[model samples]
Target: MKDHVKKILDELLARFDCLRGCEKEIVTAYQLMEECYTHGGKVLICGNGGSQADADHIVGELMKGFLLKRPVSREYATQLGRDFEDGAYLAANLQGALPAISLGNHNALLTAFSNDVAPDMGFAQQVFGYGKKGDVLIGLTTSGNSGNVVNAAKIAKSLGVSVVSITGAGGGKIAALSDSAIQLPATETYLVQELTLPVYHALCAMIETHFFACS
Candidate 1:
């Protein structure tokens, strides 16, 4: 476990009593991602509208440096320079990354899949295509009932992928489907989303600290 993992959650609890009683769920989510990355599995995220942007934002933080500077090892740096013409430049600039993909970002495929098949099945299709055993799918929906996100959760479950959710006051359909659901104590959609940012930010920081600290 990362040293800062517990610290981050503790900080959240100090700042937000509304998050009381949900510490375990939040911790479970961090553990799930930690396990997935440790086992060489990636995270797949999906949502709709604002949630879609959240999913993308998560990928942005994870697929590159967030808190710590994940410098390339000397061996890998040498290998990069040996392998390609611009390898040294690439090596100098690139940071170690956690494998993560925003399922909602493939605009072309999303459109084609929605048009060619079931519209609500877009997320499900992405889950089926990208998910593998041990991978984690994080479905974000304020209402917890987004059809596409729910469908994706269902598929992820069938395929032995771990499902974690971030939703509002009530853990909706997605909560039932998830292995762990961190439900914020907010009824309004925007408030729920407002709280979600900190929760995920904590998790992302913990995961990054876990992987890059010793390296």
Candidate 2:
């Protein structure tokens, strides 16, 4: 693990010591994500309500620069030059991205599923369509048991995908289904979300730093 990543975890512990017990799980999540991305696997995230927002936020950070300036590679720059008039401009501005998809953000598909088929399986349907072996599904639910997120995780697992569940105190049903579960010490939904933000941000930074900082 990178020092700064560990540093972020330590700082979070300092601010909320009750989360001290979750350190090991958090590290495991980081390691899994690193291996996934290193091997060209993408991440699929799902949640509800505020957690949905969190999912979108994570995708935003991962699909572009978060803590580092992830300039496009020279190879890509050259390829773009041969294809378009504004190739140099496009290449210069484009950033290397870690592929990610927020399963909660598609309104059309979600509404269609809810209206025509099983409402709780919207995320699961997306997972079935997009997930592959070696990819990861990050499910966020303060109660550790959001139905849709849980279903998506279950489907993901069935397809040989790994699951990382982020939740509050009990590490509920979703935790049991997850390969890595980060159960923070808080019962209130808002409080759990507050803690989740920093944790994922640290993860994004760690990954970004790993590839982009030295480049």
Candidate 3:
């Protein structure tokens, strides 16, 4: 890890002592995501209820600038200017993005799949369609046993995609199935969710710093 990115992880651990025991797993998850992006792979995320909102939140941070400007390279900007009359404007406005998709955000597909197929298979189906080798799947379930998220993890693994799971203490079945799992110390749904926000925020910040930090 780069020094700046490692600083972000260090700050997170210092602030959340409850996460002390989880440092190793958290770093592992970050490495999995870092490698995925390095190899030109996108991320697929899934969860349910509040966790579903968290999934969208993560996508929001990743697909756009979280802690850096993320401007496109000068070469790419120049190409844009040469391509069209409004290319200058486009190039000036466009920000580099980290590719990400939230499986629970598609209402139409979720409803259709849940109605015609099994409810627990919605995320799994999306994973099947969007996942491939070298990609990463992030499953956020407080109990670590949400059926849809767990099923999605299963499909992700079968497709050779790495899985990172964030759950409450015990790690649950998803933890066992994932490539890396960060189980927060708290067990109550709300408590776990509370800690989850900081953890992912730290992960996102570290990743953004790694890729876009200004020299």
Better of 1 and 2 by TM-score: 1
What are the clashing pairs of model 1? none
Per-prediction CA RMSD (Å):
1.3, 1.4, 1.2
lDDT of 1 by residue, 34-117 (tens): 999999999999988888889998998898999889988889999999999999998999898999999988999999999999
Candidate 3 on 1-215: residue-level lDDT in tens?
Answer: 66766788889988988788988888888899899999999999999889989999999999988878988889988998898899889987887788999898899999999999999999999999989899999999999999999999999999999999999999898998999999999999999999999999998988888888862
Alpha-carbon RMSD, candidate 3:
1.2
Model 2 per-residue lDDT at 52:
94
Q: What is the Cα-based lDDT of residue 53 in candidate 3?
A: 95
Judging by TM-score against the true structure, name the best candidate: 3
Candidates in descending TM-score order = 3, 1, 2
* Better candidate number, 2 or 3, judged by lDDT: 3
Clashing residue pair totals per candidate (backbone < 3 A) = 0, 0, 0
Expressed as tens digits, the lDDT of each residue in 127-197 for candidate 2 is 99999898999999999888999999999999998999999998889998988999988989999999899
Please list all clashing residue pairs in model 3, or write none if there are none: none
